[model samples]
Target: MLIDTHIHSDTRGLEDLELMAMCLDGVITLAHDPFEMKNVKVWEAHVEKLLNGEIERAKKVGLNLFVCVGMHPRAIPPEVDEALNKIRDYINHDKVVGIGEIGLEKATKEEREVFIKQLLLAEESKLPAVVHTPRRNKEEITKIILDEISTLNLKNSNIVIEHCNKETVKWALDAGFYAGLTVQPGKLTPLEAVEIIKENKDFANKILLNSDCSSNPSDVLAVPGTVLKMKIEGIGKEIIDKVSQKNALELFNLKV
Candidate 1:
């Protein structure tokens, strides 16, 4: 069974959900910036949709859905504290798995402040964190993320530095964190992802494959499609199973 460790189902269609259910055992939908959000109220409403509306929507297609709520770095408002308070109220929900899709966008001082606070929340709650690495200046931003993480007493195993490419993947793995390879447009393609796996010795244990499906250009079937690519490339089934399913299951503490 495959588990897509990251996706945003809020804007997906029924056809996509059905296709995913046919191929995947489950999915984790993370809270992200609603680009047009003007205030904390919008953030609150957006999260409510994830916690309530999206969960039921996934169930209709027989897809086991999980959630992670956080203020995306791009979406952090002037009143950051208010946004965080809202997250605190829902962080312990039965279906919530982590504090995620949270990290640097512009690497602003305010963004850093907000990012560090959420990291502490994840540490305090003993939950996994799914960190985002921006597409631009990825190396520099990822380094900053790692440095910030180092100051906290959080477990390495509980953090996933997501959207990692060849260079940043090594950084994440070297730092003892799960490295998420997102197979989405403008991210790593299936072949590139497989190439990274082939290059990194014993990397199956520290990798998580995801589509990061959302309103942006994405492939909802990316996790399964990548598995097919790996098979064609003669990657062993054992390793395929670990990256596509087992690693995510263990990291998220998913019972499915």
Candidate 2:
């Protein structure tokens, strides 16, 4: 009953989806809209094609799939607001999990603006949020999000701080929020993720694990691999199950 909370299947081929279908029971693909369309006029349709293709591939494989549509901080264009609103209209379906992959990066004013708008959408829609934190300004962005939750009168429980490294994990834990670790093989290896989890047992109640696999190849089922490694390291199955499955379902309001 494991569910990967933040996989990126945008570039997955048929073979990849089939393999994923066998490996996991459910998946939530967090994808970014076309960022280049800011200059081009026809970006909306292009973005829809990408999202629709992702959903179709997952369904073909018999995996219960869902998606979150938004522009990443790095991907936001000057006219991103228009594109974002267009995306909002299509997000009210059962398969739409949340407004995601959104947040301020490196203290940029533009990213902050886009993040605030997307955050508002998340609040309005009553959807859990998936957020990205910059490596350098991780604490700053985390603090900003927490502060904004109060200013916007948003609840703390509806946000997930994603791609959290060590320091950022602490911030999430301190804030009593869910945290996602992207378990790419060469990038953020499973060993590193296990180490983080091991160190943060104090807040294991709120930790979440994700593959964060885009189209790229790595150790295929990274979430299961992490669970296996944690078990071999003497971590209990209940703890493993909570991080890999239960915590995400509870946070996202999904049935497991």
Q: Return the top candidate by TM-score.
A: 1
Worst window of 10 by summed lDDT in candidate 1? 149-158
Per-residue lDDT tens digits of candidate 2, residues 79-157?
A: 7768677767768666777777787676477777778888888877778889876656667777786666557766646
Global lDDT of each candidate: 0.90, 0.74
| Candidate 2 colliding pairs | none
**How does each model score on TM-score?**
0.96, 0.87
| Clashes within 3 Å, all models in order | 0, 0
Clashes of 2: 0
What digit string (tens of lDDT, one per residue) describes model 1 on residues 91-180?
Answer: 879999999889998788888899999998888788899999999999999999999888876664589999999999999999999999
- Residue runs of model 1 more than 4 Å from their true location after superposition: none
What's the CA RMSD for each of the models? 1.2, 2.6
Measured on C-alpha atoms, candidate 1 has an lDDT of 0.90
